[model samples]
Target: MDEQVITGTTAAEIAASVRALHERGALRRGDALPPVRELAAQLQVNRNTAVAAYRLLAQAGVVVARGRAGTVIAGVEAVAQEGYAADSVLRDVGTGNPDPGRIPDLSSALARATGRPVLYGEPVIDPALEARALAWVRDDLPDPELRITVTNGAVDAVERLLAQALLRDDAVALEDPCFLASIHTVRHGGYRAVPVPVDAEGMTVDGLRAALDAGVRAIICTPRAQNPTGATLSPARAAALRALLADHPYVLVIEDDHFSMLSQRPYETLIGPGHRRFALVRSVSKFLGPDMCLAIAATDPETADRLAFRLSPGTTWVSHILQRLVLAQLTDGTVLREVADAGRHYASQNAAFAARLTERGLPAEAGDGLNLWVALPVEARIVAERLMRRGWLARTGDEFLLGAHPAPSHHLRLTVHDLTAEEAARLVDDLVEAAGRSAPRS
Candidate 1:
């Protein structure tokens, strides 16, 4: 019998065909795809069309290219609220979220939102909210002339910022083990995600330089409490990155300070003086509550103007009510204290867990943010399986990988800040036992 044939005359049709095949289970994860030239001939289309189709697939995270080794189906974990499992008997330490009990109450804030009715032709942003947001962001921005725009959230701001700056297939430098939402945004937009290796001190200078050399048109980085890994940029590392970015002034640099209010570390930025195009996004989700879904995007004038085109009134402006609510909470003395307390709570809990792991002979350092990135003595996936059996759901580091296929990792990003002292201790004991079981026999 003849082998299964894949065919399409255009890029869209080709992408649709591959997606259909994957959906039908005809193409499994890690399965090899036909070479672009071979597939073009089979489909009777131009080579560029095949290339375009593959590019689309790559951006969608449906497939990955292995250079001369050819393209293959991507084995990506579904992007969702991490560490959540339905109908499970496990304690979940994988959901990257602030404790609900700690989120600032908005009842009074919502009540204060009552005012004169906003109508068409009015400014998109709530004037009062804009004033507060501007003041809040201006404190961190190096550029005095940076303009501010509010969006639904960090993800929304990033999507708009990138959309305004880059064309499809433009390379975007993203930290390896990036945030899930950012990964989804980049893939759905059909951009090449160039991986920038992140270490203890946040984004490495060499990684940034390599990404720039690869012709990446944009970069997205987290200055503190980076997702999954919980890495923060050190002052020295931030200086090095800023120096490198100074030479490539045109590259669109986006800094997502997702943990802005809750971070234990000070904000260290990479956007240098005279850097032409850049944006710094600070979302209030971590403290104000995820449901609040508000972020401030501070960018250079040109990028702000470009972003404004998409956010023009009636198209997709963030709700004025939400803006007022965020502002109210941000400015309220009680809420401010609550946010600060929450930050300290997370830092203490993470440190406690890391110390517990250390006492168990597992060297662990709890990084900033809500999670502890633990290096295991065995394959993380294997240990995760063992954990599942012991009734604990943890996130393996592999789920956050970008670019090429990576070597197997022994890292686990556990959301243990919300865990109680007893609960955390129990989880660490389980993890230690799981690792022991999964370790290779001598």
Candidate 2:
């Protein structure tokens, strides 16, 4: 822009211009704004006016002055609703939750699944349902000898897996910035979480090696659709992890393939052959409707037997009714087909959003799940704070970090799949505006 244009601008105009620069990527989060005096003089606005405008943005979380660092663009969450702040109602872009509409309606399926309850003690885990589950498990597990154990949900399976294999206070290697449920499970189980770093290729083998060397007795990892980061484990990384685990056959390996069927990538099995202690857990929560709350875990017989002690059918079944409903749906082809379609839709939507982000000068990446992971040019926390004022809520990279050292990158984990296309587009624009206001004037 011409210097003469700024020279005649009002404080509000300067602010608007600043936002436009951020939107266009001319300015970005964490960049320092020009000094108030310089900006005021440049815009031909009174110093007081510039100061007032800057203060207003700060209060609204658009920007923050960091001691000697001057003022920076607050992170995008700055646009989040701040308790009825006049007209502030930001969109939710955090927590990669599925769109409610995408969930399969079990009404038609459940109607057909009803029948006389299978007799009590009638084959724990419901043989009929287990049969369907076995197919799903086999579809993901590379080894034929892998045994399956059905449980209430992924969490239920995790609890059982730990109970059978790990004593209290045992060290479990888990991805840093793990799923919230996994974090709580490990802590509540009295096990220490040795944080493993996750990257675009999913869990890092070097980090896993470090955790194992730290004396972790077990490791629970996701080969696909990793939570928070929305990263899938790459083939090479998965192979490396499997090779590393081969050296320590005593360590229990639990791989949570939560997005099993819904995932778009070719499934990669991380558990190597002849590994004595290992389990592959797959959850239908994301694809099968979380309400189903059922998960299938295939483990070695030793772990299955231990889980068997607590996994009784009829009285303690993962609800034969629910199992039957899911089974009937899976077999119906319509439900399974719908699930596959939904996965494709989510992947496409996230990809489109990432494209929009790229247009705004932010290089974003999409994975097989319900969201996009964006690396901001500046601090993610600052960007989130800025977006909060604009009524947008988001997740920062810091929250997902697992290691003792902070994650060095500033990134946003966004779940944008379920939202309408128009809503997503508008959100991208608002995020750009927020980024601009917080974005430092170079």
Candidate 3:
């Protein structure tokens, strides 16, 4: 990577030149570019122009800024994703998915969802769905002036909310050991993620205050059924968070209550009555099935208006048919009962597995949502490797982590609710054996 490879006067022109060079294979991954001052001097451009050019490159994923190490060409890093790996031979406990058998069948509801075809320029939300969705969230959210907007899913809602409220490189607070999609969304959107540590009680107050003091413009919180950790916000914790956030009334708060219907715990909210900007997103994927791909956002009027801008009349609105389908299933008494049964099934299975682990001399607890977050005595990667050898694919805790911690995470997030009795027993035996293998000999 020679300094001569970079050329052009303005920021866009300089960015284009670097892109062209990369396209031609002159600038390879990890190859460092000239320092801002040096590049400005060589190109005879303003220092700000050089900085802007690098910024563009970074935003485009063509380069990464390594602080004082300087800017370098970025590798095509594969982002972590949810669900099972394709063509995996092992029994995959890594998939963070709801048990498919328990998902309420939508075939019966499809007919009820259909009627007169919706046209462009009509209301974006299905009238009935809107009513039901509002009723669904009305009791939980503090804002009486809440408005509902539909999107592709919880991830889409989060992406749009952040896009509407903040600019690129603006800091956003995310829970440490965050959801996979949220992590991907913030990074892909080029926002700086300020990690707030999460514990059994949910996001730590001190951690969030630190993020706020660091000038984070927005906060994305999972009020209940937090992924990976499966930690829910207690009433007291939520109240404390709300009290802390009361002073920062203007900062945008987006609560992702993804496991709304299936969660066994009570819903706790961080949005206080007077908070100016907030959105509570609830996706139907957990109980309705992932392919349903719909979520409702109940938000403040101003945030709703900003979110509506991205969900244009014809092009971006969620399909009316899908919304109707969701409404039909939600309103069905039998389906609701089945959903409740599924919730109990998951809770029981996770509880049974935790008990087995405890009986095996490894203490564990079943938390809310679809997965169990088990703390291991040894390094998670070491245990994971041993599990792999025993024909199990496990999701290690470190994968969900953001920022640096005092020590490496020695935990595993296992989705064992879907496993059979025999399979569950085998997994426990394997896990105990794996942990033993990770121990040092005298």
Q: Each model's TM-score, in the order given?
A: 0.86, 0.76, 0.94
Q: Give me the overall lDDT of model 3.
A: 0.91
State residue 92's C-alpha deviation in candidate 3, in Å.
1.1
- Which candidate do you rate higher for lDDT, 1 or 3? 3
Cα deviation of 234, candidate 1, in Å: 0.8
Question: Residues 1-442, candidate 1, lDDT per residue (tens digit)?
Answer: 1124575788988888888888888889888898888888888889999999998887676888777888988775456545366777678888887899999777899898777877777899887887887888776785888888889999999999999988766899999988888898887776778999999999988889999999999999999999988899999999999999988999999999999988989999988888999999999988988888889999999998998899988778888888877878888999999999999999998998888777777889988998888998788999999988888888888888886664787899888877776787678778888888332211
lDDT of 3 by residue, 1-442 (tens): 6788789999999999999999899989899999999999999999999999999988787888878998888775567899998999999998999999999987899889988988879989898899999999999985679999999999999999999998766899999999999999998887888999999999999999999999999999998889989899999999999999999999999999999989899999889998999999999999999999999999999999998899989779999888989999999999999999999988899999999888887789998989999999999999999999999999989889999778878999999998988899889989988887332211
What ranges in model 2 sit over 4 Å off? 1-90, 313-315, 407-409, 437-442
- Distance from true position, residue 74, model 1, in Å? 11
TM-score, candidate number 1: 0.86
In model 3, residue pairs whose N, Cα or C atoms come closer than 3 Å (at least 3 residues apart or on different chains), thus clashing, are none
RMSD per candidate (Å) reads 4.7, 18.3, 2.8
Q: Which stretches of candidate 1 lie over 4 Å from their true place?
A: 1-83, 437-442
For candidate 2, lDDT tens digit of each residue in 107-193?
898797897866776765667767777777775665666667878899899988887887655689998767767777776665668
Which stretch of 10 consecutive residues in model 1 shows the poorest summed lDDT?
A: 433-442
